[model samples]
Target: MTMVNLSFVLFLLCGVLINVQIARSDECITGSIRKLYEELNCIPEHDETNGCITSYNCSFTNDQRADKCYYQGREFSDGDRLEHNDFRSKCIPTCSCLVRDGRAEFNCAHYDCAEFFQPPLKKNCMRTYSHDSCCAVGVYCKKENEEETAATCEYGGKVYTEGATFFPNEEPCKKCICKPGFSGSLESPWCEEVFCEIEIHHAESIRDNCAPVYFGDNSCCPINFHCAHASSDETQETEVESTTITQKANDNTPTCKFGNSTVEIGRKVRGPEECTECSCKVPPLIECVVNSECQEGKLKTAN
Candidate 1:
């Protein structure tokens, strides 16, 4: 290849390496400006005094280096309006990603909305709830609209007929009654929680280690029962563990003095008295069993 072509290739390679070295995720506070380099194919803006700082200004394909904003796993430019909600996803709709102090940060407007245990009734106006914003009233009652009251309730994106009782799909356990207001009435749709009463069966509860637990239909609370036994494998494992512990205890057992001799555990000592075989089963206590040792070696031969 020609030396001029080789030099030009080397220069492009050096520029690419310099750009790659500055595509750092840590430059942004929330590590969002890295997407401009990694995903959006952007180059770091290098100044003669400050080198490369891509958190605020990154040159994109648009042929301009502009400040960027990031919010909710997305990148946006300045003056970009962000559509988001609060944690409940039903309130505090005003959220935006904007350049506040030389850096992009998310700015949200938090409102302390009054909460009602039951659905509230708005005066004169036909009330509508919004899942997008916390705005409860969608339409207002004007003086010309004297008889524009709706007899149906609008909730969760669906209009329900008046006096309709239904279970909410989001929460199957809660039952809501839709009582939309007329032109003169003032009641709105409301929901109530149904709790099951528990009854204890004293006689059957203590019958065994395990008892039946029951649950009510479409209810979060169980019918309120207790007790479950270990599985057969679990019981066997517990038994084996107990046996191993017992064996270990016996292996480390102390000795006991039987008359003239200091005997270890499980050692059968023919007692000084007749027909009694005394053995040290536990430390400091010698258990004596009167039995077939009295018949001499006949007991061993029979076994």
Candidate 2:
């Protein structure tokens, strides 16, 4: 061959080799994994000689495909070995992150000092200690008089000691008690607000201008009506006496108005309007007392 033709052929061969090298390099990039590590800013030094990337600060074992990587920062992946550093021992009892089904789960189970200690081969008691004979490494231990094993209750995102009494911070009227159980279980202790009813009756004479009022527990009766007994003698006189009743404005008690007259709580009013007897009692409740004999007599006379 001519020297010039040979030179051109050699140049074409070199270009083919360069393209092949570029394609091979692209295959090694593993774009998805590289992007993930880049986003986390955790990609480590490349070990070109061994064809591996070393995240020196983290210890991980690669699966067959190296698709999932587990590390000990704030999370773990499935198949991760539970190690001493995975635990947070800064508070009474120790807590650790457990990976299950590719999700991070938390648990608090460490109890004794010995459990916090590493094995002899890996023994390094840098942060492990005993406080009151409890695990005290990398975390605080229960105080001398502290009850470390008490089961706690959680409600509305707040934790409470078992048997604690409190009203929900968001609902002052909802008095609740905490008992040991699952945090969100239906059987968990809860707050209960008790309610009562109030009713007011108006007299026959005032019935046209006045009406009965009803109220629930911790509520105030209407202010318009006075309760008094009618004269039983031949005079048939009606007497009305006014009494002042006041309740806290912030009590959030519900009220109901029946007519023009405001019902007075904890009072009695005679009513010939409907031949009914009524009385207002504590808790702002009102009810009619049935006169069975009178009712029976009326029925008998009618028959």
- lDDT by residue (245-267, candidate 1, tens digit) is 11223444455333324445445
Whole-model lDDT values for every prediction: 0.39, 0.36
Question: Candidate 2: which stretches are off by over 4 Å?
Answer: 1-147, 169-174, 186-259, 262-303
TM-score of 1: 0.20
lDDT of 2 by residue, 183-269 (tens): 554322354441111110111212222323322212222223333333322212232235312222333432211233334433445
- Candidate 1: residue 152 Cα off by (Å): 1.6
TM-score of each candidate structure, all chains considered together: 0.20, 0.19
In order, how many clashes per candidate?
A: 0, 12
Model 1, residue 131: distance off in Å is 26
